[model samples]
Target: MMSSPSPTTAQASSTAVAKRIARTARLALEKKFAVVTAQIDRELESAEDVVIDCFYNADSRTSQLNKDDEYVHLLKLRSRQPFSLVKSIVLKDGEYEGHVALIMKQAFPFAFMKLNMEIRKHVYEYLFESEEKVIRIKTKTGGQKLPYAPGYNTYNRAAILAVSSEVRLEALPVMYDRKFCFESTSILMHFLLQICDGRIYLTDLNVESYVGSTARTSFYLLANCKRLRRIFFKHISSNEQPKTAIKNFWNDAQPWLTAASAGQGDPTAALKLLVFDRTAFHFRVKDPNSKSTSVKAWQLADHLVFVKGLKDKLMDARKV
Candidate 1:
């Protein structure tokens, strides 16, 4: 008859089981993270901030709010890779409150940037903050002083040149030899719901944002949109690790290499604004013969410009 195992033997067996479980868990996590990173990279096929960080916080900014009650400014990543940086704005009672911009100078996108601001000590607080210190805004405390340092813009974030303008999406050149796979979301869920919910119309939505970095990637993706067709040069890069390297890589993508070559100095200037007309795009219900159609509205009418651009670039990408 086989003898019963000793207590030590039983303990050893349990430990072995635990080790196996841990190894399996690690493998599973590696696979999941790899999938997530890949999906993000594919989405941002043209973003300079190729690093990926979920920023899993409830608030985009740590803790700040302005008058407009816009507690959080959403930096929706149209592309999969993490953003090169994040530009945040704080408001109070529909008035200008404060701002911040996060950037990783040493490395590229694998780094994270969180620009948060609070309306405490509006003057000196602005004069000196960020590591690089790249802000110049007029404040109530005084003039010529950095009113909203570490912030995107003082008076209005929507006016920031990057976010406010119609710009071109540069093509990624420095791709890695080995590519990884990700199984996460390609397009941000928020923007998807915005277009699908009808809160923002599909035909009139703006592909660009007037905040941190330009929504050049959005325009690139939407360029191939159904209504207003477009084309772009898309590239894929390896999806791995701490993300700082990817961040840096994205900061230097070029458009000149691609035929669209939207000026060297202004990489995104060639956004090629199709100037979609709200009245022009007509929408109908599910039925082909249904007259249950509607025109666009002020905010809702601009969505078409956003999603359609994606459909366009996707269509004729090879030609680009």
Candidate 2:
């Protein structure tokens, strides 16, 4: 029989095998990433705004984007790339709320161009820099400090994008099927509220949901916004029921009227224009006693004229 190989030789062989496996895995991931990027580029060729939905299921081998006008194209990342990306970020419960959202300042089409190989290498290092480093820089320069805004310091993905100049991508760990009592609109709210700078022109406020006291929240949001020139509510389908909470909240004191009454220091005073789309105040109601509470195709829409009345009141108040 041939002499047994030395223990050192066997260890070397095992190390070689591990290296090969790692190389193979990285190459596979790179290929998958490249394919996804190519489809995104194709979408950018025609669509003005291309959104890349990196949301992927672990069990699924493909990531797809809806072909509708809402989304430009689909990215099928059915490989280790998605898993690897997930690993890069830490997941904490109740860290942020509502939905798993990424504060994407630049669309994926544009971000891809910005995050080249060389740039990516430095992006994470800058992002993960310590507070000590930040303090040192500030102390050395004694530069003007950033603005102090309460409920605005939480560093969500959007905040990271706002402050950083790195070629890095940030993702928030999302609770897909998990349910929570208080939905977290903190990230999106901060993003919307921070745009109050004089140079930023907010022409539209698209309300996506009305389930979670969104009306009241919106009331406060508009109360603080000074530069909003026009406002529009998202189209509400006839099948959707109007939230009683919203009606009850506004019943106490109409928001627009109250804002109009304020003498000064009221942000809503900047509002000179209001656009009411088809779904601005349209609501649906189904008889609860009916055996079938399902919404009927012929359900007539009832207009919530309360807002219209408030508008008239505001106009008269302004005239006086």
Model 2 lDDT-worst window of ten: 172-181
Off by over 4 Å in 1: 42-97, 103-320
lDDT (Cα, tens digit) per residue for candidate 2, span 53-120: 34332334343445563533344432222232322333355745343433333322236445666675
The residue-by-residue lDDT of candidate 1 on 275-309, one tens digit each, is 33333223323445874544323234234443344
Best prediction by lDDT: 2
Clashing pairs in 2: 65-74, 98-184
Q: What TM-score does candidate 2 reach?
A: 0.31
Each prediction's whole-model lDDT (CA) = 0.33, 0.41
Stretches off by above 4 angstroms in model 2 are 1-201, 235-307, 315-320
lDDT of 1 at 314: 32
